[model samples]
Every structure is written in C-alpha cells, then in structure tokens.
Target: MNARIAPPATVALQPDAIIRHARAVIATEAEAIGALEPRIGTDFVEACRLILNCHGRVVVTGMGKSGHVARKIAATLASTGTPSFYVHPGEASHGDLGMIMPQDIVLALSYSGETDEVLFILPTLKREGIPLIAITGKPGSSLARQADVHLDGSISCEACPLGLAPTTSTTAALVLGDALAIALLEARGFTSDDFARSHPAGSLGRRLLLRISDVMHTGDDVPRVAPDVGLTTALVEMTRKHLGMTAVVDADDRLLGVFTDGDLRRALDDVGVDLRGATVTELMTRGPKTIGPDKLAAEAAQLMEKHQIHALLVVDADQRVVGALNIHDLLRARVV
Candidate 1:
C-alpha cells in the first residue's frame, strides 16, 4: 500500500488579528515615509538639479515592482514640465537602449540595488556616457556604486507579514519620485496653464484651457433684440432662442442692456408699464454683467453664481454682442 501524507493544518485568522495586522502595515509604511524626510539631503537636491538642467528627456528604468514605480514616476515627470519616459531595463538590452540620447539622463530603480535586469543594462549606460541616478536600499550595492548620484530609498522592514514582499520599500520609492518631480515642477515655475497643455483632456485642463468662445453660441443662435424693440419682440426673441434672456443692442450691435424673463415679470407687475409700448431699453437691466469670449468658461460660471443669473452675453473690446451662453451651454460642454 502507498503511504499517504496529510495536509498541513490551517489557522483561520480572527477579526481582531486581521485588524491588528492592517494597523501594523499602516504604521510600518508610515514610519518608512517618516524616515525619508531626514535622508532628503544632497542626493535628492542633485537629482532635481540634473533633471532641471537636462536638455533631453529623463529616461526611467527598473525591474518588476520597481518598474511599475518607474513608469509612474516617468509619467509624473512628463506631465509636470520635466520631459521623461520609462524604458524597461530588460527591453533596453534588446535594442531599446537606442532611445536614450547622450543629452538624456537615466534614473534607475532597484530596491536591492542588484536587480539583474537593471544591472544587465548598466554597461550600455556607461558606454553611452549618460548620467545615472540610482535609487536603492543598499548604498554599497553595484547599482548605487556605479551611479553619479544615489538616492537612498531604504526601509527598516516590509509591511508584508512575511517581510519579503515590497510594501514599505515601494512606497518610499514612489514618494521619492514624487518629491523629485514636484521639486522640478516648482523650480521650472510650471503654471496651471502649462499643466493644462499637457493634460487637455482632463477636467482641470478643461477648467483652465476652455475659453468662452469655444463653448458659447454664436451667429443665429445668440438671442439679440434692438434696444428700440418692445418687450413683446424681445420676449419672442428669447423664446425663439430658448436662452431665457436676450441682449438689447444698438444699430452697431453694441450691447445696451439685457432683458431676461425676470424683467418681463416685473414689467407686468408694474402699475403703468405697457408691454406693447415699452421698449427693451426701458425694461432691461442696463450695464448688465458681460464677459469677453476670450475669457475662461469657468469665469463665466463664477459670474453666474455670484450674480444669481443663468446667462451671460459675450462681447468684444468695443462691448458689441458677439455670442451668448447660459448655464445650459456650460452643462452641455461639461464645463459647469
């Protein structure tokens, strides 16, 4: 008869044990980040200086989990005024190293400072004479020794219960990368407008880059009535344009006043005003709030909120009505 082996016994974790483990992980990671503050000295400063002066892109490379961090760091750098991109260390050996130019600087991540894939490309980096910045746990490791600048991303212990998986170490690396990017961003004097150029598809970019002219209704869509026209004609124009308001203009289309639905109601409630005889200029809100088409759509929204109105008449330098946009237009454009 064949001998049979029994399976190892399993211990189901209690709820308290699970909670305690979670707290331990959080505490360990927090302490690891806390440790980084004191270590942020010349090496971190030099990394920022090198990137700030770099004429070409910052080429980031690493292996495994560090590789993931490398990609994110590259993305952050690229988006925040520093030109950067991630190249897998393994791929670098297989002809991708050509992507690195003599003007570019290489940032290599290897927590242990001895990741083989990263090590494999070190000779190529040296051959090309590209400046190297290394992030590693071991200061004496080959990767750190070869670098022109070394950033210590060491951690006392992993958040993992086994103490083998990268948890605290990865967090430190990621945060260090962020520190570098933000420092460069500040040094470059990167503005919201500059950031918007890199991220035109994002909400913050839209808020910064989207001009009123881009979202406003122009041509025949704009609700306009001559100042001499009666409130009845202005009402018909407002209804036809479906904008709840109409701009009263002169013969030259210069904005005279704005007559909204609210003005119509007040006119009717007046004791002596006749809708058929009263002109738009008499019933309209003169010197009404106006915005230029070149202004940001966000500014338009702010004006609507502050004045308790839904629409704005877009004018030119001469205050001639050229376009109109209500909250509905902003909503349609997702700019509200």
Candidate 2:
C-alpha cells in the first residue's frame, strides 16, 4: 500500500475506450475515401448522370444504424442543390410506400445488403418499376443485385475486434453519398447562389440573398450634396450622415463624383488648395467606387476592399443615387 490511498476502479473508462476505438475507425474510413478515387469508374459517372436527370426527390432508406447515416445523407443532398429525403425501410412497407413514385429513385443502404426491413419493401418498388440504387459490401446480396446501380461501400475490416458494429461500413456509406452529391453538383453546375436558395436562413443565404439594397442607408439618412456644394458643406453633410462619405450628385441625383475624408486630405496636401472656399466640384474625386443596388453585399464588400474604399454609394441601373453604405454596415448586418 502506498502512502496515499488509491482511487476505486470504475466502468467510466470502458466508454472512453470506445471513443479511442471510434477514432481509429473514423481514420480507417477516411483512408477508404482516398482509395475510392482510383476505384471510381464509368459506373460512378453514369450514376451521377442518372441523379442529374432525376425529376423527383431522392428517397433514402435503410435499417438500424444504416438508417441513421441514410437520414444524414438525405439531408446533405437536399441542402446541396439536390432535393432528397429519408425514409425508414420498416415504415416504407407500411403506408409510407405511398411516398414513393415511379419518377423517384430509391437509395438503400446496408452493410451486408440483406437487411430484412429493407428487403421486405424491394418487391413492391420493383413491381412499380421504381429505379433503385444500392450501397453495400456484397454486390451479390438481394438488394444490391436488384438495384439499377451498385456503389461499393465495402471496407477492409471493422475497427471493432468483434467486427459486429456497422462502424467502417457506415462511414464508407456516408462518404459515398457525399461523393455522389458533390459529383452531381458539379455536373449540374450548381452554384452557391442555388445552394443559398435552399438554405435562406443560414449564413450562406445571408451572404447571397441580402443585397446592398437590404442593408444600405437610403433617403434622408444618405449623405448627399450637389456637385457645386462647397467642400465645407460636403464635409458637414458627411459628418451629419455619419457614413464617412458623401455623394456629389447632379440635379437629377445622377452621380457626379464622390468626396471623402481621404479626398479632403489629398486636397489639403495640394500646393494651392483652399478647403473652405473650394467647390466640391473641384475637390471631389471623379468616378469613385459605386455599386448597383441589385448586387450582393458580399460583392460590395469585395469591391470596397479592392478599391480601398471605406464607403460606397448604391445606385440604380441608371446610375442615379439610390442609397449609401459603409464597411460597418456589413458588420452590423452580420453579412461579413
């Protein structure tokens, strides 16, 4: 016995041991993804083409843990430009079979490809002439053999010593599903703008859908001055608006130029400039950075960054002043 008493033994470590085991399983599964690059063939491309031509939402189904992975894959597809949803195979045998239509394609996931819950629904799908795609280890299994397309989700071995849990197989299935979604995205020329439409409330959507018009200061809040206004008057308007710059516009509010503190400093540096008496027409910069209200705030930020501008004027298609915004507007809007 040591000077200090030892702590009591407990079962908490048994669960922790499983965590280490899961990490190794995940690493092994990642290796499987790297290996898939070379193994991918014409079948994979053909599968992608089929998915692209699909007129209906993807219907994903599986049993047990495979069902869990299937649900996530369905979600990933739905969010990334392809429309999809998950169905439990057990439920599909019930009234859920009504969810399937001939136009919709079914994606079934199973390690052995012999899951009873999944296999039970196969006959009806077949009789209905619904095209089927399968992900499994054994291509000879009933589900795999019946599918119109078969993707190899096999792994060298399970990370589990008993080789019982669906660890490696599930990860491989997930990776394969991601591969299919990404391939289809590229094949269809799916863009971030399109993806944003599906996720309108997310960060991506905010970046795309929230345009300069959505967050810019318009009407009285925008600092405006006639092209003939003195630099002194323009400076007062800039400070009043607190947007750091003022637009110099014509009688019709068509843009003439822009004036900012930067231009004021440059004017001050000029050998013969008189800030108090000089007209804004003489001090204002010609053709300063401006943007259309239709453009994305993200695009506006990019333009501001490229031009080293602290603020920008938002104009309509006719180039008439419509609004004003600054870099801080992007931050306040949380679109940055």
Candidate 3:
C-alpha cells in the first residue's frame, strides 16, 4: 500500500496583512475603472448612436462572467429609456437566434473574443443584416473583426494575483456598459417623469407622479369648520375627522385660516381666555400655506417639512378648499 501524503500546512495571514491585501484589491479595481476613461471616445459615442437609431430592442449576448455584465447592461439600458434584453450566447445557437429581429442591434461581449457560442452566431447576425457591436478585450480577434462597431474593454492586468480570473477586466466592461447607457440617456433627453413612467411601482415614481389630489381627503371627509365656529366646535371637527387639524373657511368654502392641535393646546393654556365664546378665525392662523390639487404629493411633503406643520389644505386656482390632508395621509400614501 502506498503511504498517505500529509496535506500542506495552512498559512494564516496576519490581520494587517489581510487588510493590506484588501486595500490593494480595491486600489487595483479603482485603477481599472480609471483606465476606462480614455477609451470612452468615438467608438463609445458610435455605439450609443447605433443603439439610439435602432428601432427594435438591443439584444445583448455573452458567455460566463461577461454574461453577468451583459445582463446588468441590458437592465440598465432598458430602465434608462433604451430598449434592451440579454440573450445567452450558448442558447442563441439553440433556436434563441429567432429572438433577434432585423432592426435590432446586437451587443456581444467576449473577453478573449473567441467564445465559440458567441462566434457561432456571427454569421447569422451578419446574414440577417443586423448591426453588431462587439465589446471585447482583443481588438483584432474574430469577434471584433466581424462586428460593425468594436468597443475595446482591455485591461492592464487582472486584479487576481495569479492573473487568471476575470477581475479588472469585468470591472472595465461593466463600467464601459454604464458609460454607453448614460450617454444614450442624456442624448435622448430622458426626463425624470419619463423615468418615473418606467418605474411606477417604485418610491421615486410615486413621488414624481402621485398628485396631491390622489391622496387628499375630499368631500365630507375633510375636517373643516366655519370661521365663525367656536374653538370647541373646531376641536370636535378635528377629533371626528382624525386628521389632527381643521380648516377654517367662509360660507363659500374659501380658505380663511387653519387651526391645528398645536393651536388647540395654546388656546387651552391661555390665561383667562374664553374658549367657549372665542371664534375659530380669532384663534386660527390666517392665510395658511396651501397647495393646489394638481401639485405633486412630494411638494406637499416639502411644504409640511418647511413650515414644521402636519396638515395642508388643497385649494383650487380660485383659493377654495377642495381637499385636505395631514402627514398621516402622506405616510399612508408612501409619498413622504
């Protein structure tokens, strides 16, 4: 029987050495990102133009680590006004090639530029007359040579100490993809509202698209009292509505003033003040800050924050109370 060989002894790094290695890794990645700055030239701009002029989706394809970067690029493009989706290069040869349309642009990534799965689909892409953009480390490789536009994603060296794993190269490619997407986004003049339309379920979209009218309490739900009403009657209205405040209005429902819980506390603490006979207008804050129903709910939140108040009256152009809301309403609507 052969003697069993003992395993090599493990060498544990010191705490300082581990920290130094981590800092070196970070610095290497930062240098990789910095190296991408000069490469964002005419080729990058041309890639943006190709994608912008495409009438169909930007079909991105890659293998292995490049595939992950390609997926992120596709998502970034789609969310930033550019229509894009990723297709696995290996699957493309297995009937996924039909997903690519004539008008669509193809973005292919291959670090070595010789990935068989990606190379196999080049003829089909070329025969179909689709514009191809290649992101590769090798400028003279078959993939780059066959592409209509080539983006060089070369790196000085892999951040991996052994120089085998894709570390710096992947970072450079990902940053390049971001550069292309942002350049296209700016060129298209994609506004915040346009982005909100694409992200309606997100908080930013809610902040931008949700109007004050959508969340305000209207009709009889609003806590409102006549200006001539007594403080006790206004407090009753505020309590019954559970909005923490009440609007003091005239007979025509035009806003005259606002009375809040803070005001109620002040009224109760005043020395020798006759709360029973005092009118709401006499104690309420006059010409209080108001917002239009057409304004965004986020604007209402800002107004509330600026004045350190919790409620706001939604008025029309004619300055009549159309609705009312408090901080609780904004919170419930997820607009704050």
Best by TM-score: 3
Query: lDDT for model 3, on a 0 to 1 scale?
Result: 0.92
Candidate 3 per-residue C-alpha lDDT over 1-336 given as tens digits, one digit per residue, 9 for 90 to 100: 999999999998699988888898889989878887887888888888889889999999999999999999999999999999999999999999999999999999998999999999999998999999999999999999999899999888888899999988889889888988888899999999989989999999999999999999999999899988887898899999988889988889988889998888888899777887899988898888999999999999999999999889999998899999999989988997
Clashing pairs in 3: none
Could you tell which candidate, 1 or 2, scores higher by TM-score?
1
**Model 1 clash tally, residue pairs:** 0
**Candidate 3: misplaced stretches above 4 Å?**
1-13
Query: Using alpha carbons, what is the TM-score of model 1?
Result: 0.93
Model 2 residue 75 lDDT?
Answer: 95
Between prediction 1 and prediction 3, the one with superior TM-score is 3
lDDT tens digits by residue: candidate 1, 1-336 = 998898889988699989998999999999999999999998889888888788999999999999999999999999999999999999888999989999999999999999999999888889988899999999999999999999999999999989989999999999999999999999999999999999998888899999999999999999998878877788889999999999999999999999998998898899898777888889999999999999999999999999999999999999999999999988887777
The parts of candidate 1 lying over 4 Å away from their true place are 1-16
Q: What is the C-alpha lDDT of each candidate?
A: 0.93, 0.88, 0.92
TM-score, prediction 3: 0.94
lDDT: worst 10-residue window of model 3: 32-41
Q: Considering TM-score, where higher is better, how would the candidates rank from best to worst?
A: 3, 1, 2
Question: Model 1: clashing residue pairs?
Answer: none
